[model samples]
Target: MTTGSQRTRTVLHLPCLGPDAVPLERAVAAVLGYARGRRWLRFRSPGRPEGRWVRVPAFGWARFDAHPPSTGPDADVLIAEGLHGRLDRTGWHAVHDALVGLAPVVEAVGARAAGRPFWELPADEFSVLDEPGTVGALLRHLGQEAGPHPAHVLAALHHRHPDLVPHLTPTTRRALLPHVEEGDSGVEAVVHRELRANAGAFAELEAAVAAVVGDARPGRLRLHDVLLWLTTTLRLAHAVELGEHVAG
Candidate 1:
């Protein structure tokens, strides 16, 4: 189904970052708590979707082609766990491809990906397990292309306004401190400079979001913290999605 006529369900991708990934089992449980019984589904590259966790009525499931689903292209939402760095090509392809897809995919952007130099769009969503309202809002935005992660949006705001960074840090920045202080020249300058350069990408992203989801920017993101913190998960989500897009 195309975005206009497709069903809307919030999906989360969980990629295996590594042995040190802070236990996704715990993360999922936390997400469930945040969701408060909203229909949460999981899937993998079964084309037929044969293998999946079946426990609740709302518990839809998938079998990812990658260790986690964030790397996949067909995911409506991804919830991988890596944060140490950007996902591999497999996952990146999946996310880029999924962005091309008619549906919206939500992946967990890792902290490393967030803090690391980015000449590209931000995908950071590593873990907002602590914030239900924020996560809930993000679920709403999953259908949109969201070219820039929520973090990017905040970064733009931060670049223009520093005062908001403090209140925004909790849900936006997560645990990573700015490579330099918020207003420092290099980190601060690079982020905003890239943001300006990314006008086209952001436009494309917004177009994607608007095409699929209309003009409602529901979710919130920080340009550099939460995403990188759980960097491994993001990589994992994209890997899963890439296979789906390619096979399809």
Candidate 2:
């Protein structure tokens, strides 16, 4: 069994993803290129090409903003919103309620940090992870309410405080940090360490994305989330092909 001190140390000392892990120019090119492809529309009926492909007037990060009931401007609104595309009404409610219920705890923790970005926080602040009824309890509660997969919980937290919490998808998490166990109490700590470790890369990515998107640039955390999600799931080759097609 892992002791409290051991877990704390694990969180504090978690390894970072080096700068080379994500190539700068290549990643930017891939994302911009992929955006040119039409968005996928699923068809509930049996055949019919399975779904229709629709042109997205605004692609890439802009698409995130274009959709109504925009996910942001308020953390609570973001948390209450569920992944309607992926989850049924029941699943959505469970995620929504579970995340909304944890608002107090999340707010309390955010209060302590005084709105500082997680990347800027010192190791000592992360001690909250080891506190008896804080982060550990939050994780347990999330597990109970949201069921086993942690992506929704982490995603909700990310929306609430993009700077403090990194958004996670199972594919991105596994591709980026395969060794880190999901559902572990120390998971957030590990994510914190990883983000801090690769802060420079993410910052560079943010700049690149900003340059491409102009005024509509998304937050660094969101860009990081999108980058990981796309690169890991779509594969760089497909992204390049899409980019080439767009350029042509």
Candidate 3:
């Protein structure tokens, strides 16, 4: 589809990076640990025709996306293109800061796009996925326009957040985009149980992320994202072991 910017865009779910033996989740945590203190972190104005300077995080994820295929107008794509060199030089920690700085703008885009089908929003708005808490707002903002698969909210969160990237990677949004969306009691129960069981771990991860990002802890939706990601990863892992794809 063409983005509102009128640029043709395609969305693709790339395979998780790195060796199969090292789960994506664990690799990201390690990247964060390595990046702490040693890397430069700052929020800079997004670059335009010629960019400004910013320190990049040491993580490969940042550097990698900083140079995505030159075909999309999504926010993350634009941001990545804007910060291409800076990200390559600097890395994930800096990219994380950039995403955080971009959060409000992304949310604003969602607010404007509210009540419209997601695809109808400007392509740049899809970049909201790269930020921490905007997708839920986007989904809620979508209201009736969220269509038949609001569980795609989980996919959005997983796509954006580094911590959830590998573990919850979906080759296609359709894989996780629920047909009958939820508000169902069964869904609520599962959410509650996952939250309870993983509360301590989530707390630790949040604290770690907060410390690294130099911000208040991420919002509730982002936290819930962790739980949803974990649940999805477990299912996906099982499917992999069974030599079958996850059921859409």
Candidate 4:
């Protein structure tokens, strides 16, 4: 039932940004650029003699949890249903188990948030992220208690309230908030500022995605998460191949 143009649009289109946003186009172009770069690297790289090309896979969003699976439930599904689920089956059990203690915390924060998305909160209202004994602090503490992989705590929180939180992976922080130190009181606020400043761009992404995918559009924060994750990952890959550092 899909036409050729529609198929092409689906392939080139990244539903995370509005069609008019330059970043959206750039994101698509980045994928294409990666493909071309990989081909060039295959034929011309110091490591070409070492079978390095065999390790590089085609660039695509499937590498990340940008969207829920079409046939099976993902962590987001379990979180939405008020249940605990691990981001990784083997490693995240402790984080999920530790998360149980935070049910009261989640309830209190949800009540205070009153169903408003994080971007919609006024500046003064958003300052809770910087305060002691608040959601931000509790989350930080939870990360510490959970041990090893602190970033998964943020992932759990984002899955719980996709609109109220942005997923903060090490890669995302390094790529987007290099100056904001881990556990910094203002980390959440800084991320919020980034998202708020580009609200229009995300809105366009949301609209474009809705136009193409109908009702299955992911949350706006998830779209931002995916866009940053995808691009950062690609950059990291390219850097690794060249034996260069990925710029923070």
Query: Candidates' TM-scores?
Result: 0.25, 0.64, 0.27, 0.56
Please provide, for model 2 over 67-120, each residue's C-alpha lDDT reduced to its tens digit, 9 standing for 90 to 100.
Answer: 233353243334424431355676665666666676676776567567787667
lDDT of residue 58 for candidate 4: 39
- Model 3's alpha-carbon lDDT is 0.34
The best candidate by lDDT is 2
TM match of model 3 to true structure: 0.27
Listed per model in order, the count of residue pairs whose N, CA or C atoms clash below 3 Å is 61, 0, 5, 4
In candidate 1 the C-alpha lDDT for residue 236 amounts to: 28
Superior candidate under lDDT, 2 versus 4: 2
CA error at residue 48 for candidate 4, angstroms: 29
Note the Cα lDDT for every prediction shown.
Answer: 0.29, 0.53, 0.34, 0.50
- Tens-digit lDDT track for model 3 on 117-170? 332333333333443334333433432232232223222222354231211223
- Model 1 CA RMSD to the hidden true structure, in angstroms: 19.1
* Superior by TM-score: candidate 2 or candidate 3: 2
Better of 2 and 3 by lDDT: 2
Looking at model 3, report the run of 10 residues with the lowest lDDT sum: 10-19
Candidate 4 ranges beyond 4 A from true positions: 1-22, 27-90, 125-130, 133-146, 179-184, 213-215, 235-248
Ranking of candidates on lDDT, top first: 2, 4, 3, 1
